[model samples]
Target: MTRTHVSLQQNFAGIVLTQGDPGYDDAREIFNAMIDRRPAVIAQCRTVEDVKAALAYGQREGLDIAVRSGGHSVAGASVIDGGLVVDLRLMNEVSVDTDARTATVAGGATWADVDRACQPHGLATVGGRVSSTGVAGLTLGGGSGWFERKFGLASDALISVDLVTADGREVTASAEENPDLFWALHGGGGNFGVATRFVFALQPLPVTAFALLLWLPETARTLLRTYRDMVDRGLPLDLGGGMAYLTGPPLPFVPDELQGRRLIGMIATYAGSEAEMRSAIAPLLALNPVASMIAELPYTEIQSALDDPPGFRNYWSAQHLAALSDEAIDVFIAQGEAMLVPSPSQHLILPWGGAVADHAENWPQPHRSAAWVVHPFGLWEDPADDDYVISWARNAVAGLQPYSTGAVYLNFIGNEGEDRIVSGFGRDNYDRLTRVKAEYDPANVFRLNHNIKPWTP
Candidate 1:
């Protein structure tokens, strides 16, 4: 290594890794196995100051910069080839104030970290479904979770975000400070800057009930229709979950005949007791699911119950719908049949309403007004199946376009295109976000995420 490289490392409080360094390759690895980027340097940032130093160094060196948090960007935006990555994983810390009912989470923290910390206090804000998802990436990009319909999307709970801007400035965006930027941060992805910390408004969630019921794929039609009917009839705000088509596992609840089979599953969570959940799930129970499990558990336990193991090649996409017509249900089920079995893929139809629709106008996320979200989470181990799996997700989204709202959740997709990105925020919000981008990042230094180009006067 050059003397300059050694000197640069000595000037920082965090660790710096160059190519061939002991943890370099592992540090560059993200959630998707399909991404194989090799950054020239990775600054393992520990503090806001460390983040600032890394940003300044990357800009001064004219290196492409990617900020790494939970490293869960499906597009692999957290890492760049032959560039610099400000790795924030080491900065993970969660501090909860029980009195104020709020949580201040470090940039690199995962949903698991926040949930665990807040669970003890009988408090939690909405977070990503997967426990390992980065708090900053999810919240800044518009987080949707199991309880989103009850409280709101993850971004909706955000009180403020501390960020390191393109110009190496430490700034905090909140309702009372830089309000325009704060609005843009909602459903804005990571376009504006590198978020270092986030403050979230917590809710009283001392108890929650969880359930998982499985049936043969043939029951998908009945299940989807029942779920649609329930939503139409005004399901309780406390209930939130999705119907998924996944590879069934060999759990005790599963019949020996159904284990390792492609099955239709309903995972429901209620913001109440198991008895309350039982009453809420009666209609579904009447459908006679082949296997089931239900219990009142800690919110943290439910957060990680469905965690997909790492090291799987992943491809995912979503379509927001204006309504779930009968035709749409059939099409959704048909696509589920195309899903790769003996794998960890999830063909999901998630209800979107209640708080999601009520608070849609308060943020930049355009898809919030939609009645439903169709997500195809594709995860498999074989590289040979990449094209097929990606195509399956793409086709699933395509089939639902007739009923689409034309807006999508950015977090649920990869690098689709500029058009999809614009659709995510809609034209008006996109214009506003661009103006904010122009003010904070005129040069577009943070363009690795779903980019919003600076507005030119």
Candidate 2:
């Protein structure tokens, strides 16, 4: 295990970047502006053998290791300070088997990449609304998206993943093989190892219709009420819906009349025939859109529509609630209308009862009790106004606590440490996950992400 004795250059067939290396800055950058950490080296790995070698080097030298796939981790967990980063962004390869309804994607692939390859054949796996998000991190965090109500979370559709463990071993975890590791990898953060590849079960890809977008400031109460009723009645398996408070941007998509304003947006998508898609959304279309951008676009374009935003500094803290109560609605609207920022920063609440709420066991994921996720998110440009955005979000969450289940999504969190991450899992689930962490990584080497610390020896 001598550091220099082993021929690392020969062992690793991928590129490595030390300090001052051309790719070091790009490798360290994450989506969250609040985080800035520099790692000693960045292993921009290509092959699985590269991942194995990087892990082995980190282990032998007692160096901290950070596993980065998309580099979009909100908590800045994908990069570390003075550590070794195994950057998987370069491993973008995919193969499809249409007959078996499955796709094996390289770990670094994005939602856009998956859709481009799969949508032509009218096949798809669970992908997020944001197109640029990595398939590995998002799916592993229990993905939610347009098709989530009909299909399941991305993790549930997983067949297997090729991972590099803490002990420098490459292994595959699937339902029928390595069952416990497979169970933990789904919705569990990167605890056991760095996932190098994913085998996902494909579902039918339907590009049916785009419903009207209704804009209303006075109808927040009615919209949430009606939305809840629709969910309770059990929506058609072909239908998917989400409602949010959106701040109008400068895009031409928003009419000049409504630019730079806040409006409640109710949007839906359906996978049936064109007529059925129209009928499924007839209830909302009746409201008469103040300004609408609904059209018949392919599912891939629809999913990636919001992929690029005029980049701005953002701060976010999120909580998943048992229900979206009237009081919660009021708090959201009040905070939303109080927007003092320049860029698109607004609160988003996505419901979760359809396929996600039916979980039967106490896995590491504690989002089971939550029916909706309230994201107090905002963005601004002036460094001085950063305080305003964070404070505004903090106060809103403080008031809405009574309705919340005290659970938070790991991916949406800002760069806080171990205690905050443990809180996100709640007391019981956090303890359970901690035990699992102890069983997998007792030395606490994998402590960068929304961490669950292994119990002290």
Best by lDDT: 1
Model 2 TM-score is 0.91
Alpha-carbon shift of residue 82 in model 2 (angstroms): 1.7
- Please give, for residues 1-457, the per-residue lDDT of candidate 1 as tens digits: 4564565587588999988889887888889999999988899988888888888888888999998888889999999998899999999999999889999999999999999999988899999889999998999988999999989899889899998898988889999999999999998878888898899999999999999999899888888899899889988889889899999887888878787789999989999999999898789999998899999999999999888877999999999999999999999999999999989899999899988888889999879999999999999999999999999999999999999999999999998999999999999999999999999999999999999999998
**Whole-model lDDT per candidate:** 0.91, 0.75
lDDT of 1: 0.91
Lowest lDDT sum, 10 consecutive residues, model 1, at 1-10
Task: Compute the lDDT of residue 298 as modeled in candidate 2.
Answer: 85
* Stretches of candidate 2 exceeding 4 Å from the true structure: 1-8, 211-216, 360-362, 415-420, 423-428
- Judge candidate 2 against the unseen true structure and give its global Cα lDDT, from 0 to 1: 0.75
After superposing all C-alphas onto the true structure, candidate 1 shows an RMSD in angstroms of: 1.0
Residue 173 accuracy (lDDT) in model 1: 96
Residues forming the 10-long window of minimal summed lDDT in candidate 2: 1-10
Shift in Å, residue 230, candidate 1: 1.0
